[model samples]
Target: MGLTFSANLGFLWQELPLPDAIRAAHRAGFAAVECHWPYDVPAQQVAAALSGTGLRMLGLNTRRGGPGENGLSALPARGAEARAAVDEAIAYADAIDAGAIHVMAGFATGQEAEAAFIDTLRYACAATTRTILIEPLNSYDAPGYFLTTTAQAEGIIAKVAAPNLRLMFDCYHVQLMEGDVTHKLERLLPIIGHIQFASVPDRGAPDHGELNYPHIFAVAERLGWPLPLGAEYKPGGPTEPTLGWLLR
Candidate 1:
């Protein structure tokens, strides 16, 4: 099969709510769907939509507090809150049958951040059977973001040593922070739980990106990655019209 694309409802279908977006993705030919955060909508509602449409829920992020908060996993002072967030994420994942949870590491630095991250991972592993993912966000987009590179994520995953803890390789961020994506994908495939893509610099659809998604897709296919490359990009226009790239 070709590289299957999962619709990221967080960026797409801005006009519609979660249920409508889930249906829209099904109608748009996406086999799976992922979102930034779906905490507002009840998990049962999202699950019902997925169940009705037969579209799998790929992943979702833990609640990162509110407007000011990016993440809690790495915050040294928020250990209790971080564990609670993990529990909440697992609850939603259980309801939706989501494949994984992207455990966001908030803006942090120094040994405390690492210690908290390790603690959070250990807590998550014992808490749920679902995959626990950590992604490296580019500093340009998420300035001072605790996890900023594959190497840093790798080290945390190593120290945590949880069987379910895995990496979330976002191509857009990776390309910005470290350009050798194909090599990194090949090397990190074992630990990469999910793969997401958006245009480098613009964070738009893959067609307009500096990176050649087709070639990258081929590399992912060759490496035997799980299906559905997550399309975590903003549509320049409507969610549907911008999807012509998927047909190609």
Candidate 2:
């Protein structure tokens, strides 16, 4: 079977409840789709869009906060707030029938932040059956972001030791932070529950950039990863023109 692909709604935020987008993805032959926080659209609307289009809901990002809000990861010191956020995210995921929730760690610095993140993760894992993914954002893209390295993420996962917690391996961030993609994937594949990608340097369609995606996909196939691969990139224009290569 081909790789299960998920269209990331962040890149197509202008068009939503995204019925047309889902139809387009289905016409192009994708099995699933994902989105960032869809707080603007009612959960029922999102569910309706999926039902009509025959597209499976892969995942969605959980909310952090408004402009001034530091975000859940930054609030690790506030266990009660973190727990509330995790609970809210899990409830949303359960509502949408989404298989995973990508928990974003906002920019928070210091050892205290680390302690809070670990503690919150343990609580989240215990509370939800759906997988929770912690993604490492690129420092350049998100300066002051708390989690930015595979090693750091692995360390947190090790400490949490929950089967429900896993890393959201974004190739774009990893490529920017550390260039050795294949080697790192080999090392972290077992712990990775989900994957996302964008072209390096520009965060566009996969084929437009330096990373060799076919080879990467081949490696993933070899590893027998059963999860969906997230198409979390900006389209050069319409998504189809940029993603034509994947259709072949």
Q: For this target, which candidate reaches the highest TM-score against the unseen true structure?
A: 1
Q: Name the regions of candidate 2 deviating beyond 4 angstroms.
A: 68-70
lDDT score of residue 127 within candidate 2: 85
Candidate 1 per-residue lDDT over residues 146-195, each given as its tens digit: 99999999988999999999999999999999999999999999889999
Model 2 poorest ten-residue lDDT run? 12-21
Quick one: RMSD of model 1?
1.0
TM-score of candidate 1 on Cα atoms, chains taken together? 0.97
The segments of candidate 1 whose C-alpha lies over 4 angstroms from its true place after superposition are: none
Against the reference, the lDDT scores of all candidates come to: 0.90, 0.80
- Per-residue error (Å), model 2, residue 115: 1.0
Structure candidate 2, residue pairs in collision = none
Clashes per candidate (backbone, < 3 Å):
0, 0
Relative to the unseen true structure, what is the C-alpha lDDT of residue 245 in candidate 2, on a scale of 0 to 100?
55
